[model samples]
Target: PGHQGTSLKVTDSPRKRGYYVNSPTYGGFDIMTATVGGVWDSFLGEGRRFWITATSDSHRNVEDGGEDLWPGQYAKTYVWAAPDQADIMDGLRHGRIFVTTGDLISELDMDIAGANVGDTAQVKAGQVVTLKVRLRDPAGPNANSDQPELKRVDVIMGDITGKADVKADSNPTTRVIKRFTAADWTRDGEVITFTYSFKAERDGYIRLRGTSTDELEPQADALGENPWPDLWFYSNPIFIRAR
Candidate 1:
């Protein structure tokens, strides 16, 4: 992906979607780190219902002189669906998904105003809504055979400012509005839960990003960076509709 990778010359059709932030692209190239978050911010700035998923990008591996992982051995996209063709397809199309790397988490559920990820919550103009997140962080070792811990979780929120400039590559309105830690949450067995409230004064969206490292933002993937110690999990956005 090119720097920011946003431009107005692209397709405007509803069916059109830009490139995705796959694991290989982000983990293999130091230059692509900025592009990863740029795409996320740019889409939400447009108020479009865009989504992202993790991929193993299976082609080769570090052992094979290529940066890839066995499919689902490292990065995985989890969809909320029944074990059926129709429901599975439907869940994907509607963005009922979360992604994790290195098995940092086995379960994640986030909701606001009873609307889960990829769903829209209708509210009064300035309704205060509570966001609740429950996640299961198993103590079992990951693919690397080392158990990585979840040290922090970030709450990223962005505005729905309507259509965007085709060339816009950044959403200045989006940011890690909150960073939660053990002191901020409660743990029950292997499950940890976090809750926070915000004012929904306008159309916007909120999603999540968590990591085992202390980097406030994901550092650019460095050469030979141990992937296991630096794990991440991401959830699709939950839209807010203020009436």
Candidate 2:
């Protein structure tokens, strides 16, 4: 799971896998909080960059006996490549992408001292850098027949200490460094902007995650229960190197 620059496939439901995210017998972790978080943290612990993508895993519709949403109906992965297929594949391979669920967010512009996602920038050790983010929720009704409003954005940081300092199963040094609330900012239309600065005590990576629901905490799902209407998005990590 902690593979090198590999893209991790995450989804809220994996029906045929015998363990959905809310399954009572073997499920408790939301893919965003548990699966993707754990993978990104572990990669950072190994001083490597990792990427993530979401899928609907739709084989057929409910009328046809499938329990998954149609592809691109509720979740999407946007890749920042050129029109060429090769370039698109290259972009996906290089982690220039973001994932969204229920069309909660339509656009995200993130930069770390001007370095965009999938880019690494050089800076002095212990340097303080500003992370700027601009995001916009979809302007109109989404798949759920309601416009999703972003409620919170979380900034997660993880120290890249190399493989020598990493554990096989978990990365203890990774955590959410900051959380921006919608109530703390004045919105313009559907867009919101956030800026924060942090000292790069050592080499590390930062990423963003946001949700549309007001539930600050992840609620446990009852056995066989699935909440498909909740909306969320996750951006790829931006790496930093100290000179």
Candidate 3:
């Protein structure tokens, strides 16, 4: 909530779908949910093209007991774009991006049929949508000088229920549809691959979350906890449009 019973007009015109900026530093702030409900609130129920981003917002040096890390030391927003500035800007505008914390994975490319992240794939309602993913775990020490292992990856799906009460903020239909482990994926050196298929019962979106721990879902951070040991990575969704 933006205070006093107001919500972002994402279900309105494209011009009204405001951007969302989040940082791990304040994960428990939004309505005190400490989860992606706000993101799902805007994305699901309408298939709206809202955008989300993670930032450092670093201003002071940590050595002085400031609350921040050096840019990319613990968080990064990876854009699937050329090295050029304009292309990267375009990628951000179009949602071709993924985010990671503590360097859990270096790459994540997911596809459904011929559509990639931020792209829409057309399909029949009963069609089976094959998901192919390619990702890499650096397997090296992260900013914290600790080597972390990727424990699992989860697939989350949510239906496009078509608009919502402007005051609405939750999608009850959203859930984790699949979970992949070392046995569930193929490995080649530092890269990992996964394949899955699900029926296109309706229009929806799918996204990925990979972590270094066995926690079914990301747990809220605790004080004095080593951030690098509990790493996680998340990819922007791939929308599905079905007849």
Candidate 4:
């Protein structure tokens, strides 16, 4: 870890606080969001690269009775990297990973339910099938949205050889009753809807990811009190019973 002479952006200080950092403290209706978005791709005049980690650069140590910042206040982005620390760093530097504060979303996939129609069978023709998921965010205080509204749902489906991103309509028809998003902590009790409808031709499956996108930093919203804006995201993809 003492390779300071390397080209990595070894900043001992914290990055500027953005949307996700400020909104929670004010009880905003919208939950703050943040994503790796993408890596720098390349830095420095040469082809050198470095890893981008979502970590709590908490400078205030709890040495005194006063705590500087909460433990794990920031996200810990783990790349699907090798045990070698250098490989881990390389994986992050090349945009090969993403960080989350709440859930661990390692993989997502979808498929059709049945080849033929039957009452007890999971899949059927002339019916809409779906996939869904929910991951855990270890560094988060859960979803802190103003009204707990999910805005986007992605149905990543098809076989291992073929895949596609199907954005579904947020409605009750495509949801798992009393599960997943339904039990999600949307305290406002608003009638948030989620749905994924598509006519099936053969047997297959789908993966769903429910997302709530809000300003990462409210103080920066174009029409809000903030001068800078940031983006927030939350999603958990799951395999659904499609018949």
Tens digits of per-residue lDDT, candidate 4, 158-195, equal 31112221332121122222223444433223233333
Superposed by TM-score, candidate 3 places the C-alpha of residue 179 at a distance from the truth, in angstroms, of 0.6
Q: What is the lDDT of candidate 3?
A: 0.70
Report the error of model 2 at residue 95, Å: 0.6
Top lDDT: which candidate number? 1
Off by over 4 Å in 3: 1-42
> For each candidate, what is the lDDT?
0.72, 0.66, 0.70, 0.30
**Please, what are the lDDT tens digits per residue for candidate 3 over residues 1-243?**
111001111223221000123423222122222254554545555777665554554554355444456677777789999999999999998889887777788899999989988899889999988999999988788877887788899888888877656766777777788999998999999999989999998888888878878778666444334455666777888999999
lDDT of 1 by residue, 1-243 (tens): 211111112334211011234432343222222233476677876977677777555555545544455777777788989999999888888889988888888898999988999899888888888999999999998877888888998898888877877877777778788999999989998999989998989988888888888877766554334556767788888998999
Alpha-carbon deviation at 206 in model 4, angstroms = 17
Backbone atom clashes (below 3 Å) for every candidate: 2, 0, 1, 42
Candidate 1 clashing pairs, residues 3+ apart or interchain:
7-166, 8-166
